[model samples]
Target chain A: MNLVLHNFFRSSASVRVRAALNLKGLAYEHVSYVLRKKEHRAEAFLELNPQGLVPALQLEDGTILNQSLAIIDYLDGQHPEPALLPESALDRAWVRGLAHAVSCDIHPLNNLRVLQYLDQQLGVSEEGVAEWFRHWVDEGFASLEKQLASDARRGRFCYGDTPGLADICLFAQVANNRRFDVDMSPYPTLQAIHDHCLELPAIVDALPEHHPHAN
Target chain B: MNLVLHNFFRSSASVRVRAALNLKGLAYEHVSYVLRKKEHRAEAFLELNPQGLVPALQLEDGTILNQSLAIIDYLDGQHPEPALLPESALDRAWVRGLAHAVSCDIHPLNNLRVLQYLDQQLGVSEEGVAEWFRHWVDEGFASLEKQLASDARRGRFCYGDTPGLADICLFAQVANNRRFDVDMSPYPTLQAIHDHCLELPAIVDALPEHHPHAN
Candidate 1:
């Protein structure tokens, strides 16, 4: 099946899809969008994703699927090698719950659109925006720290030894923490997971810096 | 299998789980948390869900799982009948994409905690908060309307005639839109689905007014 990915270099959501593709050993054409320039808002891109979000997948049949988790799940469903989720349904749900802890609860607040709203529309100061950014990172990280440090299922990654969905999100969140200068001294388990994932080729190539349009 | 649902009566996320349970014909013990009264923040609740969020499901073995979508996926997996997700992998991904469009995009920023943070911490006025509320609701509703209205697979619910995960999320969002007084005239398709869902016993029983805690 032909696959094309429309993504922003620095988007946390896009990073997950990139990592998923790399992990699954699926090859795809990469299309970069310079979000600051409003390239994603162009009519063509909107036709692909009405939500105007990045990390949309265009399948061989011209069916476009948006939302990074959904796109990753699709890829995982289509190509199950090095499976992204656990075998048992209960275990998969637990992993997804962990992923959502980061993606649903944390990332949405820090999305480019949300930050832009805070700045351009709410007239928040740069410092205020930075504080806002750090605030959410800290809140989510604290809860995650407690969850992961306590969970017996955690190994080298957020789940087992292999890197998967939750680890991808944890990796991205760690990057965001570094970008925003949020304190990492509090989350040792997360730090270990982040470090473990960075050692992998799939995750390493998917970092924002590896993207063609970084900065 | 034993099941226990820990939830807030009015939470959209919790409402999704409630609707899912009702649809799946799962007879589980109902454990309510008074979110406004800080009942969810208690130590026991935190033990169940480290994040202090509600709609956690306790399994027969006493293992608790969090996140509404993950819980639904778990339920659907355990009880195959009345499947929450479609049969084909691609169809499932599309359904998941629709669900995330509501759960991850529209609901997160409008969550009770986020709203409280905006009002108490950021000092956003009531009107400002309502504007913030409507802004996200409109952004998500516009895209969803475009998606559902354009899809040839449109039926009685978000997917087909079945009231599944996406419809549960859509149901909660429609309720939220009404609670916030967001204009409904613009999203005719959503209004129609909302009306369709209200006719179903499962969805009707899951509405906030029918909950044990609603004022």
Candidate 2:
């Protein structure tokens, strides 16, 4: 079956799916959309994804899957050699809980669209937006720091030794955090896991700079 | 095995998990946390969940599962009689995509903490918060309406004849929308599904007023 990934470089959500594909060693044709240019807003693109968002996975039969976590889970289910979710249901929930802490609790608040809304609609200043972004990152990371530090299952990665869905999500968010200059001193475990994820050759290839649209 | 749910009556996220538990016909002792009073922030509560979020499942084995979707998924896995997710890989992704659209895109922006941050930190007027809340609900619902309308799989529920994760999430968010007077005219399909879901005895029993804390 053929696979196509319509994505935008430097988008944390898109980076997440890319990391999953890389981890599973799945090859797909990458079609880039430049979000800043409103390329994602084009009628044709919106037809593919009504949300007018990136990181849509188009299957060979033309089924389009939206939402990074959903797409990642789909991929893991289809190819289970290196499972992204844990073996036990409870352990899987624990790992996914951490991933949601990043994706839902932290990233959405600081996403590019939300920041743009704050600036254009609410007239928030650059400093104000930065503070807002940092506020959420700090709050989420504080809980993550404590949870990971306390979790008996914590390994070199967010779960076991392998970098699973949690690690992929955390890695992507950390990249976005660095872009906004958010302080990372408070999350040593996060930093270490992110570093370990980056050490993987496949994950390195999925970094934003390595994407075709990064130029 | 004994089951206990720690939840908040009015939290949309918590409501999502409660709806899931109700769907599985699982019996659990309920422990309610009042967010307005900062009861969830107490030292004892925070120990169970570092994130200090409501709707954490404290298992009979004393394992705590955090995040609404994660907890719901764990229950679905353990029970498996009535699946929250579909059997086919692709179908499961579609349902999850709809679920994420609510849990990630819409609800997080209108959540209590975010609204409180706007009021306390950014000095946004209550009117401003209402507008902000309605804005996201409109944006998210517009796309979701388009999606469910366009897809051939539309049934009595978001997926099929039975209510599942997507329906549970939509029902909770629609309840929140009504609370804030967010106009629901634009989403007839969503409204219809929500109305159908409320027709179910278990689902109706899980509504906010049924909780002991609602008085």
Candidate 3:
């Protein structure tokens, strides 16, 4: 099976998928699409992903899948090694809750197009856009920190010392947050988890800097 | 097995999970936390879900799981009858893509806190907040319409005739859009799917008006 990951270097969503694939010990080809150049929005790319989003997985069968969360969930289902989810229902829910807090809540607000929309259509100034980005990140991280702080299951990683789906989602977004200069100090637990995930070989290899599109 | 669903009537996330539970032919207990009254933000609820969000499911073993997506996935995993996902990897991805179009992209932007943030902090007028809500919803539906139009697999539902995860999600959010007064004329495919899902006995029973908090 020829698995091709269509992604951009700096896309947090793409980075998360890469981390998941690597952590699962899956070997796949990488196809970089420079999002800044509007490559994802081109007609051919849109044919692959009507949403014109990055981190689309093109299977050997030529089927394309979009949406980072769904793509990762499918990957976890297909490859159970170093299982991304916890063994029990409650634990699985907590891990998934952490992942969604970042994916559905925080990252969605700071998505490239969202920022562009804020600036261009909403007439938000540059500073205003930055504020908008940071505001959401802070709100999400605050709750995430609270959730992680008191949990007995949290180890060196987001869940029980293993780099699960929540860790993948959180690490990528934390990297993005740093790029936007959002403070990590408020969320000590998240910062600790992010630091730990970055040290793992799979995550390090999947870093945005390793991508072809990276400068 | 006693399954308790903690939810808010108008919350799209809660509605999606409720629809799924009902579809699975499961007998569950309903627990209401009124969002408008800020009951979810109270200390006890916060302990259950630090995110202070609706749709936390308590399993038979007395385990609590938060996040609508995760809870629904757990339900599907436990009760495999009338499976929610397609048989193949690609097909599953497509169904999940449809779910994300609403859960990840459109719904997050118009979430209750976000609208409140726009008004209280960003100083957006009520009219401006409504416009922002409608804009993102339209953007997502436009993309979804194109995908649905191009696919022959779409039956009376979002995916292959079954009222699955995607259908449950889209049905709930479309209902929310109506409450927000967002126009739905542009996306005929979405409207069609929404109409079909509402006819299902489970979805009809899961209607927001059926909840205790509904006005």
Candidate 4:
């Protein structure tokens, strides 16, 4: 199965899909886009994904899957060797809820584009932009830490034992949090899970620093 | 199923879940919280959902589901008759991608909390707040209109003749957009889909004004 991942090295969303693909043992090539350079906004890339977002996976059949979670879902469906979600519907909901807490509630607010808007458009100072970043992360990670620390379902990863969708999202977000100096001491559960994720080669290889086009 | 939905009347995320429940013919009790009053931050509500965000569905066994899309996905899995997601993996990817375009890309940035942050913390004026809302809607809608209009899979709704996940999110967001006076002229495809959604009682009854706690 040939796959081409259109992504930037430091995109948390890209990190998610890359980790998922590696976890599934699916080999894929990278088509790097320098998001800061607006390469993602180029006409050719726009044709691939009109959303102009990175982490689009192009299937061998020319189908492009956008949205990191959606792409991960599709890959899970098509592969299913190491499942990304749990078996039961209720469990899947739990896992998905954990994932969205990061993706929807935090990452979207702190992503490069939103930060750029806060700085360039809203005239927020650099310190203010960093504050904005830490703000969302703190809000999200606080609850996530409480949820994970209390839930008996949480094992070495977000769920029982194996790394799944929630773990993928958590790992990526924790990595992104470092850039903003987000205080992980407040989130021991999340910090531990992120540490556990770091031990896996599949997850480690997906890190931005390990990306082929890392600056 | 003895479902209790803790949500605000006008939250777009709440609207999405409400429409999904209505579409699936699931009966759930409303537990309203006025977000502007910080009612969601109440200790009781925090016990239910540590995240303290609304649209949490409490099941019979007392398991609570948070995140609107996650709750919708759970409902779809439990009640498969009126499926929210498409059957095929690739098709499901397309539908989810469209849904996330609204939920993750647009809704999160334009939600009450973010707008409040922009206004209170950053001192963005009323018009600036409105501009911020419209900017994201336009950025997301422009690409979404392109994707939906160009794709052969699009029908009366975002995916096919039937209203599904994408339609639920799109409809809810368009409703939210009305508050900011977003001009819909640029997104004819989305506008048409939103129009189609309005014709359904399931969708119409889920509107904020129709909620039991609407002020």
Output the number of the lDDT-best candidate.
4
Question: Which numbered prediction scores highest in DockQ against the true structure?
Answer: 4
Mark the 10 consecutive residues where model 4 chain A has the least summed lDDT: A174-183
Query: For residues B34-63, what per-residue lDDT tens digits would candidate 2 score against the true structure?
Result: 888888888999998899888899999988
DockQ (C-alpha based) per candidate is 0.81, 0.90, 0.71, 0.91
Taking chain A by itself, what TM-score does each prediction score?
Answer: 0.96, 0.97, 0.96, 0.98
The candidate, 1 or 3, that scores higher on lDDT is: 1
Residues B37-147 of candidate 4 have per-residue lDDT tens digits of: 999999999999998998899998888999999999999989997889999999999999999988899999998999999999999999999999999999999999999
lDDT of 3 at B72: 84
RMSD of each: 1.3, 1.1, 1.9, 0.8
Docking class of 3: medium
Best model per TM-score: 4
TM-score of each: 0.97, 0.98, 0.94, 0.99
Clashing pairs in 3: none
Candidate 4 lDDT over A33-140, as tens digits, reads: 998899999999999999999889999998899999999999999899799999999999999999999999999999899999988898999999999999999999
After superposition, candidate 4 runs with Cα above 4 Å error: none
Runs in model 2 lying further than 4 Å from the true structure: none
lDDT of 1 by residue, B1-215 (tens): 66888887788898899898888888888789988788989998988889888889998899899999899998898888889899988888888998999998999999888889888877888998899999999999898998898887779887888777888899998887666889988889888888899999988888888887677
Off by over 4 Å in 3: none
Interface root-mean-square deviation, each candidate: 1.0, 0.6, 1.4, 0.5
Better of 1 and 4 by TM-score: 4
